[model samples]
Every structure is written in C-alpha cells, then in structure tokens.
Target: MPYSRTDLKLEIQTHFDKGFSRDLKILDVGPGAGMYGGLLSEYSDILDYSLGFELDCLEIYPPYIEKFKLKEIYKNVFIGDICTFNISSYDYIILGDVLEHLSIDNAKKVLNTINKNNQKCMVAVPYLSEQGEHEGNIYEAHLQPDLTPEIMKQRYPSLKLLYGNDSYGYYVNYNFNKMKETLVIEYNNLFKKPIKPIYPKNEFKVNFIKGCKFEVIGENKNNYHVEFINQKTNKVIYETDITNNMWTKPSLEYFVDFKIRITDQNNVVWENKFNAENKRVYIHFASNAIGDTLAWFPYAEEFRKKHKCKLIVSTFWNDWFKDTYPNITFVEPGEEQHDLYAMYEVGWHYNEDEDIDYNRIPSNFRKMPLSKTAADQLGLEYREIKPKLSFKKNKSQISGDYVVIAPHASSHAKYWNYKGGWQTVVDYLNDKGYKVVMITKEPMYDDWHDSKLGGTLKGVINKTGNFPLDERANDIMNAKALIGIGSGLSWLSWALGTPVVMISGFSEPYSEFEDCERIYAPKGKCGGCFNKVRLDAGDWEWCPEHKDTDRHFECTTSIKPQVVIDAINRQLEKTP
Candidate 1:
C-alpha cells in the first residue's frame, strides 16, 4: 500500500516552490506512504515559512493512519472516503493515485465537485496500469485501468497536463479557480451552460464569479471598483465598488458585447471584452410550452452562428430539433456543462414587474412576437427563422387527401369560441373533397364553461388521443393543410412546412408567426387581451376586460365560421 514513485512527488514539490505561497491550506487525499504530507510538514517547520502551511490528510483506511504515521506528518488526520469528503475549504488538493480507485462516475463527480468550488487541484494517475486489491485494503484496487492523458483531457476538459509519460501523468487544475474571477451568466431552459469571463489576473485581483457566487480575495476589498460596460456602444451597463470581501450579482444578463473594467487600489486598471468564439455557450428554454420552444429554437441557432461559439442547448422537446441540427449539442433538462463561456435562457417571462422581467427580457414580451422575444433577449436581428424538425418517416395513418385540425389549447381562452366553429369547418372540408382528421392529445373539457371545447365532430376522422409528438408531427407533415387554434399544434403545423389556418381571437396577429393564415376579430371587437392582460391560468373561461358583460368572450364568438373557412380556402389556394 506504499507509493514507490518519488519523481511525481518531486515534480509537485518543484511546482509548489515555483509559485505557491507557503501560507495555504492543503488536503492530501489517499496518501499511501504520506510522502507528500511529510514533504509539506518539513517545509512548515523549516526557517521563515515554518508557521504557514496547514496540512490535512484524508485517509480512507483507518489502519493507514497508524501504519504511515500520518498523524505526525499532517496537522489533522481525518479518516473517511475521499469521494464524499467536502474539499471546499482547502486552497490546494492532491489526488495522488486516488481517482483510479473510484468508479468512472464517482471519479468525474469528484473532479467536478473540486472544480465547481474553485479549488486548485492536482491529480496523478498511473497510465493504463492494472492492480488488484493490495494487502487487506480493498480500496487499493484500481477500478479505472485505462486512464491516459488523452482520456483524462476528454473526460475532464478543465484539467491541464503538468507532466505526463507512458508510466503516469500529473494533471493540475489551476484554471479551476479562473471561473471564480470571471462572470458566469446561466440561463436554464432545459440545460444550463456557464459563460466563461476572461480576466487579466495580474492587474485587477478578483477571484470567483461563477453563477451567482462571487468572491474577492485581497488585502483591502474597499479599494476595488468594478464597472460593466456595453462594448458595442460604450455605454456603462453596471458599476459597483467592492465594499466587502464577497460580492455576488444576479445570474441573468443581456446577450451583449460585455466589457468589464476593474480599478484596484494602486489605480491599475484591467479591462476585457466578452468573447465566446470557440468557447461553449449555453441557451436554455425555461418554458416547456411547445409553441414557445419552437418559436425560440431558431434564434438559438442564430446565436451560435453569430457568436461563432460551440453552442449547447436544452429544450423540453430536444428530439424535434436534435437531428435536423447536428451541429448543435442538445442535452436533456438539468444536465451539467463544464467550461462554458456564457449562458442564456429563452422563454416567456410572465412577471409583470419590469424590475424582475427586465433582467430576462429587454422589453415587454407581450408587445413583441413570440419568436422576436428570443431575438430581443439574445440581441439578434428580428427575423422569422423556422426550425427544421427531424422525425421518423412513416405512412400517415389517414391515407388520402386529408386536412388536420387541432382545436385544443391549454386554456379555453385560446380556443376558437365562434358558435359551431369547428363543426362547420369540418363540414366544409368534408364537402371540399378532403377528409378531416382531428389531431389533439385529448378531448378538451373546460370545467368553467361546462362544455367540451374540442372533440370528434360528426363526419370527421377522430385521431384525437394521447399520441407521440413525432408521430403527430408526421401526421401533420403528410396533411394537405392544418386548421388549429393559438396552440402548440398550430406552431408545429407551421414548422412542418404545412399551411396553417390558425383561428383564435384572444391574441393579436403579431403574437404568433406571421406566415400562418391568422383569423382574429378586428381590434375594436375586443381581441388581443391575452397579450395585454396577465393571463389568469386558474380561470378556465378567462375573458379579460369584457368578462361578465354582453361582449364577454365576443372576441372569438363574433368571428363567424365563414371567416375561418375563407382563411383555410385562401391558404390552400396559395400553397397549391
């Protein structure tokens, strides 16, 4: 159970002598022979640097504490598992042949934990070396035998190779603390990516700025003045003086050319601009709403192309966009990303307070188109960008000239409330030599209105049931045209390149995509309340402004069934 190699220990000592301050806290994990601990303790007792080092030893095997005299070498000898041990307080950590013993996931988690806490770490592993349990210590066996310099770099991108050979490799993560000095803005739609901020370390001294956690370590924190500037226009975005040792800012940020200037006590100024070129940037879709995700997805690609960043995106519906966009990395919700240059979130922010919502979006979301909100948040040019969907191609269940109608929405307010609206359109389509297929997750029943909103109409094929999204997309793809409300299916129909005849009066025409054939009551007829008023989700029959009046719900009720028929006819004519 003793380490035979002295070269690695000497190399580590050389690194320490070169730059590391003697006044530091160190943790030696799984020190087999206590060689590194002994060396650190010897330095602690010798001459002027004698009263500086605080060395701790974490040995998993309790017997090793006595066998190696770890008690004499370390100031505190803690007997515990290294994988679960809290390494946050230490300034430097040495994982000497410790990672090879842990499972691959546990090994990665250990490194991730250390890096996340901004701790400087040194890891050494025997390259492709295989060993079984040594002595009575079962923890001495190498669980990972194929670890190499290339494999380590691939698995842990933050690690920098200090020294390596065919026998062993010594990796250092000094850059782990680099994230702390840089601002990390995280947006979580489905997945989160931390944007890395570049800092000139020698000039302005600030440590730790990842996410919402911020810390500054220097003699006098009051002497530090930080200013955030918009690099594009030279306007000051934010400025603050560091009064305490720790300062944290809100994680949400506008996608802009961020320039940071820091003035230290000596009046030494440091400035750096936000650059994500070749760096990983994350954009998350916080809302799981299908329409919102589809509308915002195009801008995510645009952000990637514009910034020239390695883009990672998270959406509730990743399968819909993953295949079509092979260039972008799509992750599931809540997956962690390391070494991110910047992060952004794209979705509808419902908070009416400008103070709260302005951090997420620059302007009122209700005033902008659904897709334009993403464009505005990311500082991209406003334009309609349709996301291409990839799905399994199969014969649509309904074979022949058919028209798909999705009449259900989350709220009854988004439904087409015209009298006999859906049935009349179904009859009209049936008379127009087209089979009408109703594709909804389920029949919509509005309890407040005490009526079934969308169900199988007479003389129409009822395809309404809980079906897979890709399957529904395929059905929409094969259809000649789709008639739906201001719902996800209407957006899906448009994304599939199908002519969409959208019938809804609760929202403005600009609220949805412009290309869709939108049918709404004129402005004076009491429409567009969904965009103007804060939607009361609990109220099933929410008729804002005109509620309980003669004109209650007249926005859609006033829109006759003939208007929808004409829109559908016009769309079909234009498409064919």
Candidate 2:
C-alpha cells in the first residue's frame, strides 16, 4: 500500500485518482517495500504524508513481512510470489514498476491470471533493461528486459495502453471516470469484504477423527467465527460464534480432509489443515516445537501397541513427524475436533488467570520426563521411556565405536566447555581409545574453541554440516553413548534407547532427564530458569543474574571436564 512518488509512481496514483473510489479494493502486486514512499507519499512530497486507506500488499522477503506487520499499514500482506500465489479479482491490481523482475513466462502468467480472474490490470516494466534488482532477494534480478508496450499489446490485445517510455515499459491506463459512469456498478459487484481472524487457539489440527469443540474463556470470543472444513471436498461442515463460551462440535462421521478456518470481524482469514480420521480414536499431543514433539514418541510407541487407533500429533514439524512415524498423522494445533480429540497437554505459558486453565496441566508435570508423567496421568501401563526412531539406521561418519560429544548449543550458556572443558573431554575420550564425534548446526558456531578437534586427533570426528535432521537422529541412535548439553540430541539419544550424559547450563535436572547422570548449574547462580515464560536457553544472551557477573558465565564454566567424563563412563559401563 506504501509507495514513493517516482514519476511513474505519480502517474499510477493519477490513474487511481482518475478511476478508483476509496471503496473499491486496490491491490499493489509485488510492490517493493516502497521504503522511500509508503501509500500517501506517492500523492504528496516525502516530507509530510500519512497512511490513508487500507491497502493490500504481496511481498516475499521476511524482513518486509515484519516491517509491514509492525507498521500495521496493510490490511493484509501475502508473503509469497505473485506468480505462484492465486491472483484474486480486484478493482485495481497495480504492478508498480514490478514486471521486469520476473521471467517473461511468469510475467505473462500473472497478467493472464489477472485477466482470467476478471480483475483490472496495470503494467510497468523496464524496456530492454539489464539486471536491475532492488535489495534483499538475489532472485529479484530483472529478467524481462525486452518488455515493451508493443509486446504487451501483442500479448494482451484487449489492454488499453496509457503511456510507454524506453525506461519504463508500459502503463495500461484506464479511463475510470468513464467506467465510473458506465461500468462502476458491474465492477463493484466483484468487491469482497475485508478478511477477519478467528481461533481454536493454534494454527491447524488434522484428522479430528470425529469433530472438535471449543470453550472460549474470554470476552473477545464474540469477535470471531470458527469454521470446520472437509479438506478433500472443500466443504464447510460447521461454523459458529463462541458467544456462550461453549464451542461445541458438529457430529461428523468420516472426513477425508480436515481444516479449521478462523475469521474475525474485520474479515481476516486463517486456515490450517489437521490430519484427522473419522473411525479411529487418536492421541493429541500439545506442542509446536521440535524437542517437545520428539519427547512424545515414547508415548506414541506405547499407545500404538495398546490401541488400534493412530497417533495424531499437533506440531509445526510436519516433515519430521512423518519421517519419524510413518503411520502416525500430524496436524497443526487447534484444528482437532474436541468431540473426537482427547487433548494431551504438557504445559502452557503462565497466562491464564483462572483455575480451569491451570488445572489442564497435570501437577508435578514439570518435575519428570513428560513421557512418564503423561503416561501416569492417563493411567496407562507405565513402561520404560524408550524413544526409538522408526526410520532405518543411517551410515555413520566414523566406522569404529564413538561417543558423540555435542559441544554446541542454541546458546553459549548451555555449553559445558567454554573454557577448555570440552578439550579435556575430547582428549580424555581419545586417550580412552574411543573416537569423539562433534555434530552441530549453529550458524554462529565458533571454531577457534574447537581447535583441538581440528582433525588432529585421528580419533576425533567433526561431523557438522547442513545435512538432513534424520541423519543426526540416526547418529545419536547408533552411537555408543552421547555426551551433550540439554539439546535435541540429548532428548533424542535418550529416546532412541541410547544412554545420555546430560550437561545442563540453564535448566534443572528433574524437568529434562532421568535414569541418567545430569550436571546442572546451581539455580542460585544462573541455573534452571526454564518453563513457558522463561523459555529460551542462552542464545548468546545471558540470564539476568549471570549476565554481568564477575565470574564470567560461571553457569556453564562451573561444570568441570572430569564431571562430563565421569557421566560418560557411567553410561558406557551400563551399555551391553
């Protein structure tokens, strides 16, 4: 919606003034961030301008998404390419100097799509131009240089040409004043209301084998509408407002596809598909993060053996879920039909002021591994928490028996070896005649600290790369034992049936692991500040108490190398 007044932009603004009313929805196709000129700035000078009418924008860059989101300027921002995404019908779909950036075929496709959708089209491109890309995306390099008014007219004969220059290809002008008198009524018929937002709490849930229900706990529930969709047939099976604080589910026998669409008063729409089956009862795991998702596999395994129904996991890690459990169904959160779904919740942020919400999380839930806690809460026959990957074993980098020493973490504070502690561990393992493999994917990973593992100790392997996550999971499973921080591998190794020596820098031992030796920083001294509220482990940022301490990150530095070695020895001693 925002644009700067380059001469071409001004001309486009004049066309809007000449034809469009404030009511007709206008779309700016691939409008460059217009960093220099947001919406109103195009009509006036840069010095004084204010955002006026709500505008729609389609941008691809993430930074731009955040910028527009924070600006709250646009009614909606579609974070995708105009070519691939659906080009809906609009009163005015302006291509503000945007055509040259796309391949000729893509540009033609967009123009054809808009035309087919019966939407008004505007064009602007550089004639016979070289690569003139704006900032950020490299693919933004201009591709259609030979774009000219003659070519556009030939491609789209019905288009009425306004002005064309060697610099800017074409502006297909519309005599909106004449259209307002003649075609305004016909055009307004195509106008759509503004989109709104709704909620089931999360993005989507899949396979609500039956139907889902909601209980809106707040007054804002009156402002939104919840919808259930049959995915395969594209049917709205149910939709209603939560005025009574009761979101009851509709009786659905069997649905091939399941989706939830939430629309708010303003017409904003958010839809997500959750995997659901009509006949089978399913397990609903409450999580969206990878670590939390992986923690549920043990329960899934036990649940699978006991029940004939499939496991329905609600998480964002769809591919990971599918790859991990070929038979299990994965869905986004909140799409589960509560009438069919039996929610398995571990924790929620400390937000609800009522007792009802707090009652959902089982007491002492945070005190033990969720696998055991959940199993006990459900009164299921408790089995040893054995998390094993269903995927076949992957090849290892080193052939011989090796103990993986994971030194890298999401943050430096979680690391046990900031000051030569890991060097001692690797050297300790090397003397023990066991190869030490270090695997990591932290982009900000420093190597100087790992100078000793510089492929010098023929026994040490640095298996770090941008490889698939499965390979990492497989490595953890096959390793003799894993000596790592409180990371995904730490969780995976334990679940994959391999013993783990867990070293914690920012968390307590009870909450994360059991049946294993754990070394943690004392809470009084920068330790165990994790839960829903204080979620992040050190990501180069420090916990408040440890940030500027005279001890220099004593939380992690406090753990001695021998402590890790002893833990590893204890685990290895029990192996086989």
Candidate 3:
C-alpha cells in the first residue's frame, strides 16, 4: 500500500520529464510510503534546486507518514483524507495510483475542486488492478475496482492521455493555463515520444509553429514582442509587440527555414529555430490539376529524404503515386494532420494580396519550367524530375502502332489555335502508316469560340471522351508518340516515357520538359501569355494582349501544321 510499482513509477517520472520547468509547488495526493515524494525530491536535485519545486504530501494514515519518512522527504505533510480535505491551490496536484481507492463520485468531486484557478493535474491509474484493504487500513481498499481507461475518459473528458501502455496510462488536464482556450497537445498510440517540452520556462507557451500557420499563446501578451524570421534570408517575416493572449500568422512558402524569437517583459529572449528532423512534416498539393500534382509530387519525397522526417503527402491523384512512393504516407485533403512540426502547400498562386501574402516563391513562377517551380518553393535542387506513375499498361484494344493526340485544353488559350492544324497533322500521321487516336474529353471543338477547327480529326480513330487516366495511360504507353498542346496530357505522356510533340505558341519553348519536341511560332505575335499574365479562371478565352482581335491566340494559331508534322517526324525517326 505504501510502495508504487517500478514500471508505474518510471511512467510518472516521464510525465515530469515533459510537464513543467519553473519553480513551483507540487502536492502528492497520497504519498503513502513517500514513493512519489521521494521521486519528486530526486528530480528537484537533478534539475538543480533553483528551478525545483516545493514538494508536499497528503496522507490519511498518520502512522505511515512517520514510517515512510514523509516528513523528511516532503516539505509539508497533511494527515487527512484527500476526498474530504480542504485542499489549497498548488501549481500541480498528482493523484498517482490513488484515484481507484476513492468512490467514483468522490473522485469526481476532488477533481473538480483541484481544477480551480486553471490549475494543472495529473493522474496515474492501473486499469485492471484490484486491491482490498491493506494492513487493516480501510482507506487503502479499491472502491472503484471496475475503473478502465474508457470509463476514466468518459468521466473526465478534459484529461488527455499523455503517456501509457495497455496496463496503465498517465493523463494530464489539457486546460492547464489561465487562458480560456484549451492547450492543444497531440498524442497517439505510439511510444518513445518527443522530449522537447520539458526544457521550456513557465511564462508562456509556443505551440509548434507548423502547417502554414502558427500560434503563440499565454495568459496575456501585454509586453511580449515576437518575431518570425526567415533564417536563410535573415529577414523578419512577422513581428508583433504585445496585444492579446495569442498571436498567429500564416506563410505561403511550403518550406522555409524559420527562426522564431520572443522577448518577454523582463527582456529575456526565447528563440527557437525550425527543424523537421525526426518530426512529422506534411506536404499538400493545392491544385487538382494532374500535371501540376505530378510535377510537384516528386519533391515531397526529396523533402522527406533530405530532412529525415516522417513525411505525409496529400494530392488529388493519390493513386497515381501512392504505390510508387512507398516511403511517403498518402492522405486526403481536409483530413486532420496531427502534431505536425511543419507543413507546406504547393501550387501556382497568382494575384495574391501583398499585405497578407508571404510570397510562396521568389519571382514570377512562369520564369521557370513547370516542375522546377515546386523545387523552388520547397527549397530543393532545381531539376526536371519526372514523377513515376503507378498505373500499369493494359491489353491494347487497338491493333497496330498508333499516335495519340490531345487537342483540347481546359482553356482555349492552351489550345493549338492554328486553323485546321489538328486535321492536317492527323491526316499526315494517318497516311504515314500510323493510326492516330484522339484522346481529348470533347469530341468536337467546343470552347469559348465554339470553332469547328478540330472534330475527331477527320479520318483518325476517335478514342476521345471520358476515359479513366489508367486506360488513357495504357493507350499512350503503347503508342509511338503523342502530339498535343502544353497541357496535363502532355505531361502525362512524358511521365509514361512516351515521346511528346508539344505544340504551343502561348508558352516558351522551355516551359515543359527539356526532351519534348517543342513547336512554337513566336514571329510577329504576342505569346507565352499563360506564364506572363495572371490567369483569370472565370474567362475561358483569356487572351490578355488581344482577346477581341484576330491575333488573340496567334501564339498557337500562327504555329503552322508543318512545324508539328516535322517534330512528329523527328520523334518517329529517333524511336524507330
């Protein structure tokens, strides 16, 4: 009755290892044999007496207090039952292996009493242990013998599991501070946890700054000055001089080496630098565009390897890379990302508000190739890395060597606007003993212009219309080459290892992969508008320079069919 289990004692010590750091008062509720009091005294000595605590104890039996030398170990010992004792306020109250001896109703009342003034409390309970009256002491009997972890959680909803195993669990009241908002601490079923919290001071707490947003919290931010700086640039991204109980800010860059410094009223500066090593880091793809996701997905793996952290990734096309990237954990968008040390969102952000935006990249994203933009944002090596696709080649429905062409783009600006360009190329490929297959979702030319420039390409095999990406991938894989605009399908064709003849007047020649046979007509025309202008998603026919004139899409329109035909011929010659 006076001694605690060796394992249970070690578990309780682990809590103290992470819970508090300032000099304060601690009340061990039932220090029957000075088991907890002696442990606390040892910790006080280990931390040097300056930051140690005033250890006290409350015991029902007066004889045990003297027998266990509670008077020598603790500064004060109150001889009374904790259930009926008029408890005074303390910084922390421990009910280690003592709650089961009291009735459920009395235990609840005691917990409510100690939860005043935002006081913190911890409890250690053995779920399956049962004990009768020990040494003829009635108070030592287990009154609530059927208590389990589920029942404890049901009774005290605010108690979060701090550390535990199947036999016993250590829980702490998360409403520890005086602030109205409950402190958030993430816990899972894993053991061998992070040990960073035990080294902080008692004034204010800074939650792990991660996942695009961060929060600095305390009872009040009266004279506090907080600054978040980009370590690499040595520029202060955010600075605040005391206004409220909490301060928060958001960053756009997916990966930023940040240094957070806080100056309290006493001029004591507390600073922390961001590190993702051995921590959980999340990378989210903000775009549903297939090409964009594939372009950026490989960088997630690169980030994981470089940082040596547990990486979590979310993308629209998770199945495409889930099997290929086994080291990364694939999650859905909006799923709860718990206890992340850092998080980054990768996408093309245009027309962002200067006052609030934290600049996701250094310059106009259009200046670099598609995939390199992600590399820049995530602070990785800038190279054209092709993401591996998970879809396998299926049995071909077509009999012979074929050519795939995706003429339609999401916007008309991305289309090959040259009049009758697709028909000429389709005819050219068809006559050259290669079966041309159209893979666009639309069967006819139906964009903002509603022009009849491309309709199943006259004599080619029309495989166009709503097919799965896997099936589309299979068709492209078996084909000799693919001829299309600067769109997602072109990116997919490149990823599938099929040579692509990419035709575009709107974008620069180096906008896509370096190996693609790029066809562009830049003579006497305004071109590369997609990268130059802030794209308006609402406008289907968005020609920034000349939308209403005939030169509206001359970038692609002026691209002669002969140029694309020559590119295709070059690819065929090389592959053959």
Candidate 4:
C-alpha cells in the first residue's frame, strides 16, 4: 500500500506551509516495500530524515535500496518487528493498512505502544464491515481487527479521526480541524459584548421627562406617573394624574407621535412608543429573587421580542451573571418561583422519587440534578468526570536532566500524607546524578524547603503551581515516571498511558479502572474504602470495623521509600 511521490510531497508541503519548521523525521514502521522511502526522496526540503523497518528481507530489495541510496539519507531501513523498535526519536510515525493483519490483542498492544512513544501519529486501515468481504486476493496472513472511528475513540479518546482521501490509499490524517475551529470561535465570542449602563430611577426620570399623571392605587405609598412626550420632536407635551390604573383619552391631534415612559419609585421600569396608528410588541423582565431579576434584565433587553416569554433566571446569581449574560429576567429562589417561560437552576438537589412528574413544576423553572437526592428524584444519569488535558509536544529538547516529583491534591481530605518519603526517593535519584523537579502548589514550597530530608536532595527544581494545566499534563506525559499520591494527576498519567506509582493512603488500587501497574498501601484492617459517601469517625473509613482516631497516618507512612524506588525501577525496566 504505497502512496505516490507527488501526493507525499504535497502533504509535506502542506505541513511546511502551516509553519511546521521543526525537523520532520518520518518513521514508516513495517514498510512492506521501500516505496514510501522513495517518496520521501522527492521532498528533500521538508524531509530531514526518513527511516523504515520491515520484517521481511524481500520488502527491502537490493535494487530498491540501492536506487534510493538508503544509507546516504540516514534511512536506517531494516528487517525487524515494529513492536521491538524504539520510536520516541521520530516526529511522525505512520501505520498504514498494517492493523488489519494483527490479532485483536496484538493490535491493542501495538496501539498502546504507539501511543506511549509517538506524540503525533497517523493510522489508516481499510473500511471493513461485517457484511462486506475483502476484494483483494492478498496474503492469508492478514487478519482484520474490529476497527472504526467510534471504537478507536473509545480506546483512545485523544486520537482524533481525520478525513481520508482515496488518492493516498486509505490514509487518514491525524489533524483535528473541527476542535481547532470550535476553540477559535469560543475565543472570538469572549470579546463580543460591552459593559452595560447603570442609572438611578430618579436620575433617569429627570433626564427624560418633566411632569406626569400620578396616582396611588394600592396599599403602597409610592405614586404611579404617566408622562407624555412627542416622539418626533423629543419634547414633553402633556401630563396628568389618575387614582386608578387607567389611561386618560387625549385629543386626537395631541396624541400623534406620542410616547410614554413609566417610572418606579427609584428607577425606570417600562418605556413604550404609543403610536395609535400601529401596534407594537412589548417585553418585560420579572423575578421572585433579587439576584435572578438582575441577571435576566440584560438578556431580556437583547432578545426581548425573539422569545415568547420573559428571560428569567435566579436572582442569587444576578450580580455575577449580569456581567456576562445581562439580558435575562431574575427571580428569587423561594417566593412562589413562577413567571418565566423557562427556568435554569444552577444547583438543584434530587429527592428520592422514581416516578415524580416533572411537568407539574412550572415549565419556566429549569430543572437540574445538582445533588444525589435530586438525581434520584429526576432519575438523572451521571458519570464520574474524567481528567482530560490536551498537550503539545515540545521539540526543543528530546531529553532533559531533571526528574519532576509532582505531588499535591485539590483537597486535604483526599490527599494521602506521604510524610518524608518523597524526599527520600528524591535523595536516592539525586545521588545517581539526576536533577529532581517537584510539581506542587505554592503553599507546600515552605514545607518541602524546611524538611530535614530535603537537604539530601540535590539539583531540585520546584515547579509548584507555575505551569498551566495542559503544560503540567505534558510534563507528566514526557516524564521518565511519576511517583506520587493518588490524585487527579495519577488519573491523568493513567489516561496518558504513562508509568505511575500511586501512593494510596485511604483508598484501594483495585477500586480504580485499570490502565497501568499500581502499588497500594498494604492490606490491613484499614483498607479498601470504596463507599461512595464520606464516612464518620466510627464508620468504615477504610474497613467496616476500623475506627479513624487521632492517628490515621499508618497507610502512607507504612510504605517505605525503598519500596517506592523498587517499584520505580520495575516500571522503568518494563517501559520501552
């Protein structure tokens, strides 16, 4: 399955045109023929080096190798298994139409290997369906694995599927155009709105009107005023007072080009163009809560006529929501929450009721399952949110001097206190001439600096809370191996397919989804705390009978530093 030299040149040129200045080393693993190597020879400007490995000697013929001058281009074309080949040095690796020949297990193993090594790669396979049969009478060695975009996504969420062209022999590019476009649109929409205007009711009334018809209708002491103005000339024409909420008939000649501005006790509530000749659409914002009322005002103003009902929201979030979404109607939480056509609650708790009728609640109030009780009431489906971090390969340096020790968790309750084990491990690694880089939060810097164990560690770099989320993920992805407590970073390392040693203090390793090898706290009375909810002091903090007292550091402290170093050595030995 060889692509034409012209097509390969065009692909390389496309990457070059997009400012891909970094050296483009192409790795054609299991290259059936030296045709791809020959294609690279046509584009010397873009191709810095081209290497191919084939299992059979027949694939790399003497004439073919001699014609391309394989040795001169540093082609390194050889006969070997792609599984055994080290691919961390290559910028781009291609596995075209080779997956169908391997067994399902082997295919998975190969994919895992490719993911572990290559930062970016292109994989292509024939579009095979259960009903369809292979048209080509090729070798019997080819065995198809169940392959599709959906299956691939399930196996490798980070590997984006790209459009393939038939001209390239069933080749799919790895570039993610749609996600990039979405990010660009989101960035542009951030600057679309301007700040809103704030004016007092009395100030607004004095600036726009003079006198108006005033009347006290209800128990409230404030008076209702109807001020008249000429719309065409922008001049106050007439004013009057009425005790009841009724309009007074004006002379036909005086009513032409007239408008009315209604003011509340301290602010202008309503304004309308009162043209008798033509009917006009009206929109209003109302809410039970102060926060909801403020948040809905601006959204109502922006899309008032476009919607059938007032754009109502919770009044509690009005101040913050107003800054971003300004045209919504705000309503209070508990005061007979009804008015808007639809309602969206930010934090809704679920109550236990399998057959509760949601329709009984007003269509306006947005229902969301915020709590476990609410989720039960609504029969809402929920999933544990996985850590997803996007990373770009830094080609600046293929290798580095330092070993980063990333330790820190968002919550103290979940974090397993490792005591001084990290320092001990760092001291051991540092003694072997490896610089230690510790990734943690700023608050823990003093803790690490003041420790007696820290004195033994040399060439230590503290990247505590300095790197961005994605960059931090990238750092872990490129690390030799991560040795840390069971935090989100451990989950991230598992997702990235990196070697990790999780220091489980109060949790069990078997409870988590399997991805990589893990070493957990030695099993005892206090182990396997798999309960969904947090436990009380007497309840099963780890086991049913184990009571959490003043001393709860046994799980973390019991695991020796030598044990961690041994685990690291074992993982490093296994990882290619």
TM-score of 4: 0.31
For residues 1-576, could you state the per-residue lDDT of candidate 4 as single tens digits?
222223233343233323233356667654443444443443332333331222111122243344333444334665445556666677666665566656667767766776676456666565442222233313214465456665656655545554343323233334556455654454354433321211111212111111122223221234545656766678766655433334443322111235666565646656755321211212222233322232223333333333333444444333434444444444454545432222223222123652322322211122221122222211223322222223454642225644556555433323444567777777787786566666654434365533423333345675666566556666776777676665556655655567777666555564443444556666663543433333333432333333366445455556677878887777777655
- Model 3: lDDT of residue 140: 80
Q: Where is model 4 more than 4 Å wrong at Cα?
A: 1-389, 396-402, 411-418, 448-459, 530-550
Model 1 C-alpha lDDT per residue in residues 1-576, reported as the tens digit of each score: 455354445445435643467778889999876767755556422122432355898999887776556777789989888788888889888988888899989988988898888888888888888889887789888899988888888987888887777788888888534432222221111132321111112223222122222245422325567776676789876777764455645444657666777777758466666777888888888989889988999999998898898999999989888878988999988999876767787766645563336766778888878999899888899999888888766897887889998877778778877767788888898898999987888653424332554343676787777888888999998898999999899998888799999987898889999988899886579888987877889998788788888888888888888888898899888655
Better of 3 and 4 by TM-score: 3
Candidate 3 residue spans exceeding 4 A from truth: 1-27, 30-200, 203-224, 243-245, 248-253, 263-269, 350-362, 444-451, 454-456
Give the TM-scores of the predictions, in the order they appear.
Answer: 0.63, 0.45, 0.65, 0.31
Better model by lDDT, 1 or 4? 1
Model 3, 1-576: lDDT tens per residue?
A: 656554444445434544566466788888776666656555433333332446888888887765566777788889888877766767888888888888878888888888764677888787877888887787888887776789888987768776677887778886434321221221122243322112111244343433234444322225667777888889987776754455566444556677777777757567777777889988888999988987888888898999998999999889999889898999999898887777777877654452213366654677778888778778788888888889898888899899988877777888888878888888888788889888877765445323635543577787777899899999999889999888889999999889999988778887788878988875777788766766776898888989999778888877888888888999998785
In model 1, how large is the Cα lDDT of residue 286?
90
Q: TM-score: which candidate is best?
A: 3
For candidate 4, the lDDT comes to 0.45
Model 4 is weakest, by summed lDDT over 10 consecutive residues, at 202-211
lDDT against true structure, model 3 = 0.74
**Total clashing residue pairs per candidate?**
9, 32, 2, 33
